[model samples]
Target: MSRRSTRAARPAGAARPAGCPCGLPEPYDACCGRFHAGAAAPTAEALMRSRYSAFVQANAAYLLRTWHPRTRPDRLDLGPGTRWTGLEILAVRDGSAFHTTGTVTFRASFRGGSLHERSRFERVDGAWAYLDGEFPD
Candidate 1:
């Protein structure tokens, strides 16, 4: 089996005592937690941040829900042993509340390494959703 297939889902409802895993200054409940609890993100960037937090928390349901239907994968496997450590938003463009499309460039650091990606988002049915992403060379 591939590494992705070998991955297992973390237990749902795991408690987070610290701030959100997305590197936001606010506590989880005030930040990404609200989004996880059915509250809509106000902007594409906010959705992007919450999605990052979802990955950190192994919240696969939230990830699938926030992904644009056209491009959303059938399954998301957050391959095991990966520990997301930090996030840095490098830039954002046109993902405002009034805009339909936007992009966010960020660096996500993990245990063994880091990845730099420029992600695209779009508003679907008046809610922001992840569309796609490109890795920087």
Candidate 2:
């Protein structure tokens, strides 16, 4: 069997906590929540943060929507037992209002360990979408 690391989905109308899972100082409603609620992220970093928040919440729809069409999978399967703990952005390249493409390196921690990747992003229809990533050696 092939193991897949995909995003999950949050339950309907769940009460938000004091802060965003993205680790931003702002509250959930003010930070990544806005992106989850339909607002477009302004930069690649913003999109990356929001995506991390989505993973933490198991919001598969949001993750898929922000994925580049060329790379998006037909379905997501976030490990049912996985528990996301936090996110930390390590680096970034271009990906902004002025740039069509950009890259963000980050580490996403969970119960046991963490995932590290340098993700790529590009604009599609004027909105940033996740393209792909590479694991550093």
Candidate 3:
């Protein structure tokens, strides 16, 4: 495969921590990469966190495709100075429908500083995807 296709076939393998927030029962590459590479994610929260990681790593294509159409943005400009500190999965439940959602509360740090939010997700066509989120002070 040519360099371009190889890059497209396999998204750059950034230094993902030993395990991923997805809880997909494997490392980020083996787990989420499967989904990022066209396979399916196991649950809503998994897909959401993986998308978060994708953003942190600057994977634009993955971010857009996984975004729900109703709320999907025309473009994803993640910008600069945004560093992900850590992830704490608060809870995941009630994912039995296309609109069924779940929440993942996590602490993220960046140049602007740090904040915590409960990100939301929804499943569509047997694939879980990120929607939007809410931040609480």
- Winner by lDDT: 2
Instruction: Tell how far residue 110 is off in model 2, in angstroms.
Output: 0.7
lDDT of 1: 0.86
Candidates sorted on TM-score, descending: 2, 1, 3
CA-lDDT, candidates in order: 0.86, 0.88, 0.65
Q: Candidate 1, which ten residues in sequence have the lowest lDDT sum?
A: 1-10
Model 3, 1-137: lDDT tens per residue?
A: 00110112335785543655343346777866767788776666567667767766778899999888789999988776676654545554554344467666655555567667767777776677777778876
Off by over 4 Å in 3: 1-26, 96-99
- Alpha-carbon RMSD to native, per candidate: 10.0, 9.2, 10.7
Using alpha carbons, what is the TM-score of model 2? 0.86
Q: Write the per-residue lDDT of candidate 1 for residues 38-65, one digit (tens) a residue.
A: 9999987789889989999899999999
User: Which 10-residue window in model 3 sums to the lowest lDDT?
Assistant: 1-10
What's the TM-score of each model vs. the native? 0.85, 0.86, 0.69
The most accurate candidate by TM-score is 2
Clash statistics: count for each candidate: 0, 2, 0
